[model samples]
Target chain A: MKRIAGKKLVFFLLFSLLAAFPQIVFAFPDEGRFVFDEAGLLTEAEKEQLEYMAQELGAERETEFLILTANDTEELDLSEYIGKFYDAQYGTVATNPAGTNAAILALDMENREVEVAVFYKAEEYLNAARRGYIIEQITPYLSEGDFYGAFSIYLQSVYEFMGTEPGESPETDPLLPDPVMIGQEEPSESIFFQWWFHVIVSLIVAGVAVALMAHHSGGRVTVHSATYLNQSTSRILNRSDNFIRKTVTKRKKPQNNSGGGGFGGGSIIGSGGGITKGGHSFSSTRGKF
Target chain B: MVIHYKCQNCGDDMVFDSNTGMLSCHSCGRRDRIEDLPEEFITARFTEDEAKEYHCQNCGAVLITEKSTAATTCSFCGAGVVLADRLSGDLAPKKVIPFTISKDEAVKAFQKWCRNGLLTPKGFMTGDRIKSITGMYVPFWLYDLNSRVQARAVCTKVRTYERGDYIYTETHYYDVFRDINLDYVKVPVDASKKMNDELMDKLEPFPYDRLKEFKTPYLAGFLAEKYDYTDDELTERAKGKIANYIESYLSSTFAGYHSVSYQQKSIHTNKTNSQYVLLPVWMLNYDYQGKQYLFAMNGQTGKIVGKPPLSSKKIAAWFAGIASGTFFILTVISQLAGGGF
Candidate 1:
């Protein structure tokens, strides 16, 4: 009975050790886990909450939503660091026949750099333009020190982007609030409402009014030629209108250079998605918070 | 030389009454047809001395008069006296337009005109500072003029239209020529040096149809002036008065052209005849802010012309009100168009 017990204990110990091995060895990103706040930017509770939400959303949409932060990466470039991190965790489509679909939001706290990188099937949905829109939306939040809110929005955006068709925009998501359109100038107030415009117009009107009053201070001449002219004897003795020449002038019509509206297709980074020297393919938009 | 029309009924001094168009006695209310008066009475007594000082017929007071004054009242007796010597022979007027507006009516019209001055000073608007009002017959030269106008010009009619991709402008050029003959009669030029030419010109259309042959009785009750300048001396001014009329008449013949550039234009105006005439005017002298303002009214047609003192404060307030109102309207319009806030 003692020897049987010993064997069972050993089997149980080995089972426990095997289960804990992945956590000990691979500390960056765990499968089925989304939030990785290496820079200590988020509270433990925030991470846990975001992780659960991302996990559920990722499963439903069939795309991995990631949030990553690092205090410093030494000499490693931000895009390079995220690319390497992605490559180590999940290989690209060429290497892994089954492929990985993921959208990664990585922040470098020390460098003040933020990037949205897409991998595998995510590249089809979150093209550089859509990624650019997500960045623009989250930047204000990040700048305002709303890390948790920014991350939550980023996860929601990625999930919504994946649910739509490859060529479609996530802006059409019914659950999302209306966004300020990207690359469009903000609508300005009308000139008629401007202070200077009113001043100038008023000055002109007042000047003309005053001038007319001053001119008519002396009465106008009431007599016209017809007042004294005798119509019976006065007549047009000779009148002639002879045609001389005709002239025609033409000007070419101006051309219209405005393109159609909506999201621009194809790749947006460097004319196409960038490829690392290590062969990790991604479409990304990067900026300072 | 100074003669008074004595009433045949009451022996009181008679004056020409514009309302009755007859010689009237103010004391007895007697009216007499001027035509029924004897020829000797109408011609009056003419003296050849051309005296600078004369005695009033009723008062025998030396009448104070200017060199150009043909008729005036006696300062001592308040009698209406006419200097018959000035109205005789070469100094006589051929026609006269009698004063239809009485003194009371003239003063009332002046007050009403003052009330209508929007920018005039507050004190000036009441018209209570009137110093004097005088009925005077100013001398003028009535001209019968003929204008012969010959003009040549290059004119064009321009039209613009649009096609699929281009804008086209078509211009049709024309050579226009006009020869016009125009006649203007009784264009009066003020011949008195004391009257302002511009002020006299403004009080026009003097009811020339009411003109009557001049008689000494017409000048009995009012101050009158013999022409300071002769008809020959004022002929150029009469021509100048009709120059604008001739030019406008020539332009009327070229009405259809869009633009005209005159190549050659000549206006030849000649005087067919002229006559010395007397036109009635009411002159009001007002004193305000130590400045004297002269206002003139046409006696026949009751037209008033003068410049009243303007109030700067009122003008400024008016400007501000108009500006703010216009601004508010413009803002509302832009808001309705979905532009301004």
Candidate 2:
């Protein structure tokens, strides 16, 4: 008994330990990687830091810039080049120069407008920006040869930026509407009239229905059988049962002098006990024939 | 020799009444002189082996002879004064928690439970529909065990660095150890074959301090029975409960691990003692659409828990409303987008 009990205890403990394995295994968030755009929107301090860190970490840099003129819209081969740049930044193209860190800067010649987009690494950039520092801190240091110092400064800057109190950023408003009320106007006359009319019509219909029901019901005995009869009549009319009966009656005719005569007297007489009554039955049968 | 008392001119069997403290005789109106028995006769103790068993005359159910003396009525039939069967075993209960909450309280608790479940169907709470709420002292084996769990896992540390054009990944591994001491209390293993084990477990953690000596007087208004499962079976279940907790605690403590391979893992549990006690529960059975649904409420705490029947028509209507509303909203949005009003 003792040995058996020992085995049972061991089995139970093993079962419990196995059940809690999944919860313990996966608990950490994924690592962070950042992408930077051109036009120097990021602070110089951030760019220098990122550059030094990139060199120290042996990270590759890929950049592509394009200028487009709205006047020359016919021969615009910008899509092929943009697609290539996108492939280099996001696609699994090893030899492509614009790998991972590629930022596309599109210059519209006609409008004199510029649009910069960093591919694949926007989350990293946002994380850095959230720390109150920009890419400019790391980029310049990467241009210089002190890779170790640059990387250290970049990491410290990111940590410091992350440690600082977060303030409202422009990125928070992309899809969300402003909280403040923009404009106010009086209710439209048509919508108001529509609602009022519906309410008035519903009330009038209810009132008329109640009045008619009351007027018809006063001083009259309400036999439940009468309501059933009304329901049956409505059902018959809706189903066209009367029309079917009329058609069937018009097609059939009596053949003999007997009141119930059709195919034969013997056959009809057996089934037509009520129709073949005494006295005026023969006269009515003759009239029918 | 026949013991009889004469009432003036007539003779009849006469027994002493403890409450009235007088010997009364029928047939002829007369009171006989009462004789008091020694204190030893009034107070006697019977061990598990010595206790006698009595069979219920009405249902043929057997009960211990000791229990029969206190409970004049049969536990099975609620019928009066049945002779007890012969006691044969050495496993008689040493203590029992008498019913504190009465039958009326149980019924009220059941009705309150019904009222609280607002979405429950109508006609369920009607007084006539309640067949019977029999109070039964269900048999339970409480096991206490001290557990020691040893576990190991491979911890991971991820280091990411870019090498020229590509990011290189490196991960380090480590072994984790955990030594835990657990004192498991009152792991109840239900003895009834008919009762659901899962449901019983869910209705657990009853305070054991309220337990009192087994007295048949407590069985007067409530229903109760001894456990069918032996101490061995219950001990096994208690060990299982302890193991579950230990594993959960270990897994939580060893977070950020890639893979956990437990080696030399063992749990040692020692049974300190065991007790048989009675806990109160209000049970309700509802029949809907030719099917029975069972609900139970903890009598002492008044915590109600049960599954209710779902209406197919209401579910269909809800689904139809959702689909229609979604389509209407989407259509309106698309029309506005297309500038078609």
| Best-matching candidate per DockQ | 1
TM-score for each of the candidates: 0.67, 0.41
Q: Which stretches of candidate 2 lie above 4 Å from their native place?
A: A1-289, B1-89, B125-128, B158-170, B255-264, B285-293, B305-308, B313-341
lDDT of 2 at B21: 31
Instruction: Give me the overall lDDT of model 1.
Output: 0.77
**Residues forming the 10-long window of minimal summed lDDT in candidate 2 chain A:** A280-289
lDDT of 1 by residue, A1-289 (tens): 2432354356446434533342333122244368778899876656665676678779898888888899987678877888777776777546765657788898988977788888778887777656766776677778888887788778766776677654444454443223332222223534655656777787678768876775666455688888888889999999889999999999977775322222222112221356654476777777666
Candidate 2 local Cα displacement, residue A36, angstroms: 36
Clashing pairs in 1: none
For model 1, residues B1-341, the per-residue Cα lDDT tens digits are 67788887888888888787788999999988866765453355455465777998897989999888988888898889988778777777888998988888899988887887767878888859889999999998899999888999999999989998998999999999988889999999999999999999999978889998888788778999988888899989999988888878788788888999999998888999999899999999999999999989999888888887888997897788778877777666644553211
Each candidate's DockQ = 0.31, 0.01
Model 2 C-alpha lDDT per residue in residues A1-289, reported as the tens digit of each score: 2432354356445434433342332222221123232223333443343433333332322222111112232343333333433553345444433344323323223332222233333223323232112223332443453333333443333333322333364234221112111111113223322434444544555455444433332112221211111222111111100111111111223344333222111111111101111111100000110
Q: Give the per-residue lDDT digits (tens) of candidate 2, residues B180-229.
A: 55555566677666567766665655555756554333333334555566
